[model samples]
Target: MNATTQDIEQLGINTVRVLSADAVQKANSGHPGTPMGIAPIGHVLWAHTMNYNPKNPEWPNRDRFILSAGHACMLQYSYLYLTGYDISLDDIKNFRQLHSKAAGHPEYGLVDGVDVTTGPLGQGFANGVGFAIAQKHLAARYNKAGFNLFDYKIYAICSDGDIMEGVTAEAASLAGHLRLGNMIYFYDDNHISIEGDTSLAFDEDVAKRFEAYGWHVQTVADGNDLKALTEAVKNAKEETERPSLIKVRTHIGFGSPNKVDKASAHGSPLGADEVKLVKKNFGFDPEQSFVVPDEVLNYYRGKGDEGVRLEQKWNELYQSYKEKYPELWTEYDLERTGKLPDGWKDKLPVFDPAEGKVATRKASGKVLNAIADSLPGLIGGSADLAPSTDTNLDKYTSFTKDDRSGRNFHFGIREHAMGAALNGIALTKGLIPYGATFLIFSEYMRPPIRLAAIMKVRPIFIYTHDSIGLGEDGTTHQPVEQLISLRSIPNLMVIRPADANETAQAWRVAIEHKDGPVAIVLTRQSIPVIDQSKFAKAIELEKGAYILSDSEKEPDIILIGTGSEVALLIDAQARLKEESIAARVISMPSWELFEKQDAAYKEKVFPKAMKKRLAVEAGSVLGWHKYVTDEGDTIGMTTFGESAPAEDLYKEFGFTTDNVVSRAKALINR
Candidate 1:
């Protein structure tokens, strides 16, 4: 408010703009326009609104900021550097350089202050919703009348590209329906994109759209008006019942003399001449690049240091809270540190083969219910497919607008949004979140699933009705290629458990898995649970591939299978033995996990000396050759399935025991 303070604020904002331009120019790649345009927004957030401790970026209750329009990540990097986060001035200089924390996009674990990895448009927006959901749930579960232990707000800066993406629509709808008041998004309405002006495609009133979604919407006519931006954020904070969107009309390439408001400024860096001009326009020396005035750096750092005192105050209150409610505090301490309760693994269900046939999806449901009480912070639901996917937590109530304490979530029929939101939830410390849909629909969620993999976040993606096993759903719903497709992602662990017992162990692996997302592919039709007494223990599921049943002799052939097909392999192996032929059966649930095993273990599972192999599965045979050597053959669906019964579909797709036996005989002869 004072003259000196106001000058420093303006100087800080300009420094952000200039620094962003320099970084992009240096990298020779990246979107520089939006950062230059939205520097004031960043200035306002750290200096005026957000409560975050740079000294401790892991502070549990600190407000979260997501750069949803992640192409403009230099904006976030500028703020992170200025605010005294672990990001250094040299880090800015090394933007987009190999191994630098300043990645082209804001990566979660790679960067100190970034809350989630965001690159695909609208993912960050949905992630913000997830962050809001986590905050609300944590607050409801832990906060007493005065403690307010988990009242952190979730903030994001989105752009025209993000607003135009369909994921934001689903996420915004869900956020509004849940009445997540902790969410505050700034829509950067620059009206420009890579192709051309947004009017070429998007020209609708964003405010009215958000209003229809039940969000409290406000518009600031200018991005540079710090007072108006601050006022809008203040108004958003006061509305404690609905999520808020403050549309800030920013200018693309705000300070660049020639490139302002042009599509040319959107993706590529402003040229060297334009960069100098931008500096000159912002009252900086045209010759200087990456320049940060001492006053500007000190101003932002001072704002960041305020968070230390705020956290200290919270720490004192937390100590009192501990004394007043020791039991709750114990839970809080455990949850915040992301530690599972002692002996939580013992609560997982162990299925009996005598329980008759059970669908893996149904088995997953039992596992979820069995473990729900033990892991208090685990929460999730389906994309309105809970009944079919069997992903509902049976022992817990649903998480709704009125009750945030419930563990179950109804993510609606929005797979993509649910996928994006799951990333947000997983990024939050102490919370393990899951989402479900049919494996066929997993294609709709590729963006989020792949993003989660790239970030190495562990969000359990439970997809039921894997392959053609769902029956009667026909070709449109049957997922012939889905299994192999999921396996293709680098860091994702794709598991298709064989039976009830294997399904239970798959959930075990899912819960314990870290640093990457897990895709639990399940069948809709019932299948025989492997008798653990006669076969290898289901606990071997962690090894990814194992000998479920073996021949007595140095066997003539090997049969490998996953999920429902594993049962067929078992039946085939028995038939082969009756014919005076020896056969070995291997259960391979996850290719990614198997690849992680040492060479000796891998060789033991699929010995190089015994090369004659046959594999069976009701999905695409894409990646099976790695295990089934060049001398082997695979019986897999190379075409779509029909609307027949699951039994008929299995026979039609060559997924029966007879088919597997025939394939093994042929492979042995070859």
Candidate 2:
């Protein structure tokens, strides 16, 4: 790079720093240090290192970048604005405002170039690992000797907090084990957090830890040395056998005079006067905020033209590739659009409902095998629970760093790693990835699940042992609050299907959903299939909640349940009818879906005018407050359950027909 080029690059990086500080200062409430410290690193990575098309942010082969330390969202927003993405300077001015593209944190679909949504610490780190793995798999499946179909890298900028988080350790360990050489990360060693120096809580040698995990580690002493930063990145790219971590030692708020390295500079913007002083110190107009020199604007805007040319070059190569390998080109085109083969779903085995009762988990395996036959892009495995969760497809091979065409992944027992890796697979376009484990273990996978929600990636979570009915394994194995906790996450669809048909429907919905993640909560115990011929159509589950069985007329009472408990409500309805009581049984598979139903439809199912209702579920009653009205009761556990046989445990825990009948009767009397 020439002297002028370096100046131009500095202008771009400085513009980001000033714009971020200005935006945060104007908002009067935001983090500033991270943006300032990470500006140079972000600049070098986006402008020189990463391969992305600003015009086509969704380019399937583009390199993925994640700001794992998302509190420094200004770093990303600034880069988005300058790099000719769709974001405007005015949008940056409106940072943190409602509906602004620049939200408090980087959200996936909300921003054009952001690869993943990140706010929770360490999530982005793991997501970066996921993106790297996806590239490896895609390359192995498509690239021939002359056809480098997929060759993109995953770059992430993390902070001390991100490295300190347990989830980060979990993700890094897996990334190392997978030998993903395409993954590169920069640690912003600012040594500061909300509580002053991170040394107070984190003094461990991160490089040593990563090295122990089998990663290539490099350290740059100064953050401002572009030459060193570039060299380090080059070295990282050269290492093709292991992932690389470049620890960049940076001064927090490097150019700010009064706040550099201070805890106050980390979260709060420097006051207006102090900002002016800092601008003057940096040889800029003291009074001006967010001022971009014309030369700087011209230099950065020119990147858009360069990007178009780069894309054209790639297109020319792609054309040649198509001519040389038509079959591979066709396969690539199908994968890019995320389309399943015409006969993919044909093999989805449908077990006879009359066939002896089977655990939903076992049924899930049959469904997966059928889907796998038709959908070559469908790939995933469990967190060392595939055999138990019944998630592995028979005859499918395992996916290794060397073998990416396999349909199954051995995620060991690392739930957190499995979740992050699934996100990576989903982020890699043309793949439909899933992760599985017992529902109770969702807590371990929650961070990645939240990232999936934030990124709006369609990562299917197959969670069996969904309730207290899991039994014998004890309360520790039960998921009392998982449903509500999962439902609380935005963009995550929590589907607890009642039977075989509903399970099929759940899979269909998950498969068809292009945005957001979906969890299919299943049961360890067999749930009787609701006879669609006698009851309401199973298709009604699409509405989220529907009257599975209705009385001859408008019912005097309603029994609402989900998953396995729907059978209990059906049995309770029979006993109520014998006593001349009119009761309707509703199977509520997904509260999020039910809420999507029109008010009229919702009222028709759980009439606003009716007060007699009973909510029966073998989980926490936290989220039932809205459906149950005056005198309505919820029969669910409030505490952990005991270890015992599932049937006896259900009876002992008041998840019995008698309990349901009594609860309904009490509601009617009220």
Candidate 3:
């Protein structure tokens, strides 16, 4: 607050602005305005407010920072470089170039200090909500009365575009309802968008809107006022019953004389002459690009050193807590590393076909409940469709504002927010989260699903009502193309389990597969479980596509199916035998998993010599052609289904034993 200290702080803030502008100008393809405008908030939070050690970015209890407006990534890059993080000045110079750490957006794992991969507008905002939920849940489950081991705040800098996104609205509402006191978001109220000023479309009183959502809203008239920004954050932290949103008014381009308040500055570089003028306005050398005065560097590094000391204190506290609660500490450590306890899979229930047929969704519910007691890290719920999705953990209480220790979540009809929040929880490293909804609604939350795949995070998505079998609800509820569409996402494992045992194995795969997101598609109607005693073991599902049953010799024809359609294929196999035509039944549960198999294994499953093949699936037939040769045919729903009983719909849609037999015989004759 003194004159010399204030001068140094101002110098550091300007240094961030100049460096960010230089990176964008050098790249010639980046957003430079918001960084220039929001540099003061960045400097205040990273240098003085947030407790994070750059050297140990993954410290479990460290405060999380997300640049929700990730287009202006140079702002984050400059701060990372200045604060002694692994990001170098040369990396900033190479912004937006191939192989550079400073991508056009802030990618989580690509940079040492970036917490989440954020780009498409409001995703980072929702991700921050996930972080807050993780912190609250961990604090509730692990922290002792005197030991505040899991207490940490989540902060994000959002922009006009971020606020406009519907996902942010959903996440903000949930955060407020949960009373996530650890969340604090700063809105960069520059009033500019890609098209023009927000008045062209957006003109709501954002503060009042958040107040309606149960947030403690505050406004800082000037974005550049560090003291005011600091005080606003302090007050936000003190308010424990609600999340906080601070609207900081700012110019689109803070120092550029001509483009200061223009929409043009929102994305493009300021050009050479304008950049020099802007530097002159900030009392910096016009000739310098990516320059950091030694004093500025030292000042920020000092802050980083302070973070190290804070972490050391936490480490000492954690050691004491470990001694006091050894068993809890062991489980906590395992959760952090994403390691399931030994023999946890032994808890999964195995079903017998003679036990009577069961819907895959019902079987999934039983499997979830059976393993919930052993896998403490497994936690999630449906989008207000828990009973329908059969995703509720019945043994546990609901996760609410009053009790964060409960594992069951009531996501409440917000599929979009549920997807993004799951990503946030997965990113927190101590929990394995899942979200459930009907297969059709996956369309509503595809962005977060794609983001989860991109980030290579583990978040299980349980989508029931898997096909036309979810009948009587008409075409809107039935998912004809959802299976193929989900398969299209790279790194996403889309597993449509054939029956109860297969559903159990899918859950096992989801829990063990940590490289990316997994979707377990289940059925609403009961289908006869394959007799495991006579056919291949259900565990063969991990191979993706396995021969469920085969003839006495090399089959003259092959029958392939997934989900409930597999049962029809098996019945068709029996009927084909009456004509002395040999057939092999292949349960192709997951295309992504199948593609991972070696070429020799793939050839074994669908051999070239046995070109006569028929594929049966009650969904789009687009991707099934690869398994069936050019001489073969596919029996699937080419058109949307009509309202009827599930059995009537299947018979009407040609997803029956007779249809499968006819298709197989036709393929063989061709």
Candidate 4:
């Protein structure tokens, strides 16, 4: 008797479920229940619903799949192996092990098919929104009369934990408002959390909530119902106006008779006996593990073959498009490879000291618009703080439902979602996405920033009101700890430019930085542009820390500062000259970039002989010890600031030339 297609399909799905359970049981860790429950969803997506080429995971037009519930990464790993991605079965067996491709969660660069690094629940959900926005923008910009080059959709499997995360709520609201028709999500409505049934805490009309969010909603009664899952995906694909969410009710630990629908199987491995029972129940040999029947392999590989054919057809269309629209083709190619056009950097604005005082944020606005046309993929917006953040692109129209080709974005007041969405947009090849808000509100964006660092993706974060400078808003609005807090995050480049020229150079560094994320902290108050002819050129800002004004002889003391404080130090250097004191002022914009320099270069900048040093910054003085040394002292905020003007706040907080010179004298005397 011959086995039918349905029989092979069910076998393929159960094989993943059994393999997943076995890996967890062997590792003695990981969530066994979600994987066992969502095997059908995984199977339906990889084998039936999505368009992806296993042979080339980086194919730009492929449909993206994000596992929002990253604890259930085994489900993704199993399917990735079965579908012939670069991940092997051995890699799957070594789940959660150090240096293994199968990390505890799906990390973007580690695994071949993992699109974004996701573990903190709703971040991946928000990333899907970014991916959707990228698809729309690219489709509108690149797709021609006969070519649909960017029509691929973004998909994600979100769990109840994801739904409960605040970031997801923010992302969902924005996705609905934008009518991201290219986005579809699978909400895994497994009623079990680590505690117990969701009834222990959550019991709300989720479908109605999504409906209210302007999303097209659907429900599949059973997780095991492959036809229903496929049909739901079909319906979601048909809704081309609003983003779609299909809520599927699943039984956690579906095959473990005792742990089924129980929280016991949520984060731990099923016992050995229960694993045997699961294998036996699934009609597989209980003794044998990680068993993938030859027929099931053929079935999934056959599905992968479909992607090859589809991509071939697309390649043909792209060839014709390249010929028909040569100029557009060049721009598209540049975006795809993330290469800037020839002489694009020549467009960067150079500020003159004679121009008077200019806020770094204002200079940043000029820099953004200066090169906006040169860098087609340079697109971003502020989180409803464009006027204050100075993040708007002047020449372009706004990117809205009506116009997707616009470079400017209005992320509204959703910083959490904006950050998460920027991560998604960064993952999309050919786009450099940035988002902005006040420095104090960076607390809302820390998670996404950390994840972006983990993924080593490029997403420029423009943080203005960088100190107690935006004074009238008071202590609550001022950021005394944000600079040091952001600096603490590994792989994140935190730069606080001193003047307009340095701010312009910071933008150049941000555009050229290929590694992790960059945070450009700007000032709300005006700062005098340093005279380039009298001191070093502003291009020296790329070195992270540079000597702005050096003493004719070996300096008696070193004065260090970042952002606005650099101006104070420069003035202190001048005042110290009158007192017959030789003082050198150093502008240290980025510690991460400075650390990357060689030891010899570092020693040259901060010689061990120079024990008399003083550093000034408006933010926390905590991390300054590394630069100032034990013998040196720093003039910075030791406590929260008050609601006074910037000048008074600076005076009250001791960020002044007199205080700096006094601190320098004290340091030298010590």
lDDT of each: 0.90, 0.85, 0.91, 0.92
The digit string of per-residue lDDT tens for model 4 on 1-670 reads 1459889988988898899899999889999999999999998899888999999899889999999999999999998888889998888888888899998899998988899998998999999999999999998889877788988999999999999999988999999998899998999999999999999889999999999999999999999998899999999999999999999999989988788899999999999999999999999899988788999988888888889888999899888998999899989888788788899889989888897999999999999999998998999998999999888888888989889888888888999999999999999999999999999999999999999999999999999999898989998999999999999999999999999989989999999999999999999999999887887544578889988899988999999999999999989999999988999889999998899999998888899998888989998999999998888898888899899898998888888888888888877877
Give per-residue CA lDDT, model 3, range 1-670, as digits (tens). 6787778788998988888788889989888899999999999898878999988999998999999999989889988888889999999999999999999999978999999999999999998888888898898899997789988899999999999999989999999999988899999999999788899999999999999999999999999888899999999999988999999999888999988888889889889899998899999889988889898999899989888999999999999999999988999999898888999899999898898899999999999999998999889998999998898898898889999998999887889999999999999887999999999999989999999999999899999999888889998999999999999999999999999999999999889998899999999998887787886444578889998998987898999999998988888888989889889999999998899899999888888888888888999999888888688888988999999999999999898888788877777777
What shift in Å separates residue 328 of candidate 4 from its native position after superposition?
0.8
State the lDDT at 386 in candidate 3: 93
lDDT of 1 by residue, 1-670 (tens): 8999999999988898898899999999999999989989998898999999999998988999999999999999998988899999998899999999999999988878998888889999998888999998888888998898889999999999999999999999999999999999999999999998999998898999999999999999999999999999999999999999999999999999999999999999899999999998989999988889999888888988999989999999899999998989998798777677888889877778887999999999998889888888789999999999888887778999999998889998899999998898898888999999999999999999999999999999999999887899799999999888889998999999999888888888888888699999999999998887986444599999998888888889888889998988888888999998998888999888888899999888788999999988889989888888789898998988999898888888788888788878877877
Residue 465 in candidate 4 has what lDDT? 95
Expressed as tens digits, the lDDT of each residue in 231-294 for candidate 2 is 9999999998899999999988878988999999888878898778777866789877778787
**Each candidate's TM vs. the true structure?**
0.99, 0.94, 0.99, 0.99
C-alpha lDDT of residue 615 in model 4: 87
Candidate with the larger TM-score of 2 and 4 = 4
User: Alpha-carbon error at 599 in model 3, in Å?
Assistant: 1.8
True lDDT of residue 620, candidate 2: 88
Single out the weakest 10-residue window by summed lDDT for candidate 3. Answer: 532-541
